[model samples]
Target: MLKNKNLIMIFREIKVGELVDFVNTVFYKNANIVPITPQRAISQANNPYAQPNDVALVLALNNKEEIIGFIGILPGKTMLTDERFFWNTCWWIDPEKGKIAAMPLFYSMLKITKSNLIFFDLTPHTASIVAKMGFMTNSITGTKVFLRFNLNQILPKKYAFLAILKPILKFFDSCLNTMFAKKSAKKELNYQVIKCFDASMEVFLSKFKPTMLTPFDNTFFTWISNYSWLTTQPNEFETAIAKKYYFSYITQSFVVELLKITHQNEFIGIVVVTCRDSEMKIPYCFFDDNATEKVLEAIFNYAYNKKITTITTFHPKIKEQLKLKKNTVLFTKQLVKHVGYPKQFETLGITNKLFQDGEGDAVFT
Candidate 1:
C-alpha cells in the first residue's frame, strides 16, 4: 500500500491468491465500504485463466480506511492470437467520497496491465472517462425483445416512488399479457437444461473453435457455471455486503444453464442462458448455421412457457432472426453496447475480432 496526496492509500495490484483475505479482513467487516462481495471474490480466486501473480483488483482507500474506488480485472486469453488480455470487470468510485481517487485507481490499473485491457457495457459517463484514457471504443448492436409487460419491475427502476404502485402495475401487466396470449401449432424440438456441462457438450464445442474469440472450453465454462457471481440466496454476511457493494451481488432469482438442443433425434446446438429475475440473456449460443430457425423456435418456446419478461442478445445472427419473428414477442428494441480496448491492440488487428455476447465479465452476472 502506498499513501499519496489527500491521505488516500492505493493497493496497486491485489493478486488472485490474496483476494479472499482482502475481501474478508479489510473489506466490509473492517471498513464502512466493501470493494467486492464474498462470492465474487471466490470466483475471482478460482478463475481458470487467472495466474497467482495476476492482478485481480486495484483499490483506493480513504483516510478512514474505507474503500472508495476500485477496478476489477479478470484475466483472459485471445484464442486466435494466443495473447493474454485483461477484462475490466467492474469499475466504481464513490461519488461523494472518492471523486479525486478515480484517476488514481484507473491509472494504477493501466500501469499494471500496460493498457492490455478490455471493458464493456459503458455508461455515458464511463464512456467519456475511458475515451480520454487513450482507449479505443467500439459498439455492438443488440436487441431486447419483450415478451411480457414488465412495468412493475421497469417503472420503479427509474421512478422510485412508483415502487408502492407495484400491485396495480402487476395487475395491468397481467391484463395486458392475457390480451396478447396466443395458441399456435406446435413444433418438434428437444432440449435439456443442465446446471453443469458434460463431456458430450465439450465435444460439441470443439468443432467451433475457429469462430470463438475467447478461449472458451469445458474448463472455462465449468468455472463460470460453478462459480457464478450473482446469487439468489444470500447469507447474513452477503446481505450486508450487498448493501455496500456497488455492483450486482444478489438477485431475486438467478440461474445459468447449458441447453442441449436437439431436433428430430439429431443434436442441433448448445446454448448458454442466464436468467436473472424475469430477464433472460443468451450469453453463448453454438448451433448449426442452417438450423437457426429451429434453435430460435426452441428458445422462444422456452421463454414463453417460463413467462420471461424479455430476451436479450448481441449475436448478429440471433438479432437478425429475432427481427423476423416480431410476432412472437410483445415488443422489441435495438440496443447498442459499448466496448473499450487498449489502443495498442489496434496494431494487432483488433478491429476484425469476433466477440461473443457474453465476452469478458458480461456473462458472469
Candidate 2:
C-alpha cells in the first residue's frame, strides 16, 4: 500500500514465478483492466534468462480492488555493464479513473528497479514525461518502406470515412501492383528456416557477439524465438481474455521466425523477421558489413514471397541501401524511435548507437 497526498493505493508487484498463475486465476475473470495477457505472462514465466524473483509487473488498485494502473518490466542483462537491468515494456493508467495513480505507479517501478531501467518505443507524450524524470532520451533512425500499397489497411484506421473506400483502394492496389509486377518478382535465394539454433549458427554468432552492444547469446535468441508475446492463432479463451487487455494481445496474424541466409552455398546473414498482419520488422539482423547489399536483397525477396506490405528496419547500412533501391518499394517513410535510459548510464559510457532496432522488449512484441 502507498499513500500520496492522502490518496491511498494498493500496489501488487508480480514476480516472474507468479506471473502465469496470477494472470490465469485472478486476472482472467476480473479483467476489466489488465496489465498483461495470459500468453504474454506465460512467455515471461518461461523466459530462461529471467530469474524467478525478478519483479515483472506492478499493479495499482483502488479501494474497490479494480486495477487502474500498471508498469511492466522485462529483466535483462546488459552486456556492456554485465549487470541486471529491467526493460520497461508497458505502462498504463486510465486517464479518468487512475489519473492520480500515475506518478505513484512510476515511483513504484523506480523503487523496484532501483532506477536501472531502459525505455524504448516511446510516444511523444511519454518521451516528455520520462525526460522530466531524469532519463536521457535518445533516438534511432529507421525507415518503413512499403512494398505493397496498403492504404486500404492503413488509412481506414485513421479516417473512419475511408472504410467504405477500401474496395476502391484495393482495386487501385491491384492495378498498380500489376503494372509494377516485375519490380516485386521473387528471386530464389538459399535460406533455411530453423526453429532453434544449431551448432554452426552459434559458432557464427560467437564471433560477432563481443562487438554487439547487448551481446545476446544463443540461449537468449532461442527463448525469444520460441516464446512469443503475440500469436497468429488464438483459442476461444484467449480471444475472450483479449477484450479486457489494452495492449496488443491478438492480431490478424503474427509470426516470428529465424532465417539463415546463404549465398554461393555459404552462410551470409541471419535475421529475425517479425510479421504482424501486413507489416514486417527486422528486429535482430546480423551480417558482415560487406554482405549488407546481399542480405537486404534476401530480405526483400522474402518480403515479396510472404506478401508483406511494409518492412521496417533501423540498421544504418540496411536503411542506406533501401534508399538506393527506392524503385523497388512503393514509398518510404522516415521514422524516429525514441529510447530512454537512466541518467547513470552516461557514466557507463552508453550511447544511442549501442542499441539495435529490436532493443528493449520490442522483439517480443
User: After TM-score superposition, what is the CA distance of residue 242 in candidate 1 from its true location, in Å?
Assistant: 1.4
- Candidate 2 has a TM-score of 0.92
Task: Rate residue 35 of model 2 by lDDT.
Answer: 84
**Listing every candidate in turn, what is its Cα RMSD in Å to the true structure after a full C-alpha superposition?**
2.4, 2.3
Kindly list the per-residue Cα lDDT of model 1 for residues 1-365, writing each as its tens digit: 55656575656568899888877674448666676777888998898888988988887876676777888888888764656788888888888887777887788888877788888788877877899988898888999998889899999989999999999999999899789844332555477787666788779888887777786777878887878889798898788878887788888888777888888878888888888888999999988788888888878777776778899999888888888988877788999998888776678676766678889888888
Global Cα lDDT for candidate 1: 0.81
lDDT of each: 0.81, 0.83
Please report the TM-score between candidate 1 and the true structure: 0.91
Listed in order, each prediction's TM-score against the native is 0.91, 0.92
Give the deviation of candidate 1 from the true structure as CA RMSD.
2.4
Error of 1 at 136 (Å): 2.5
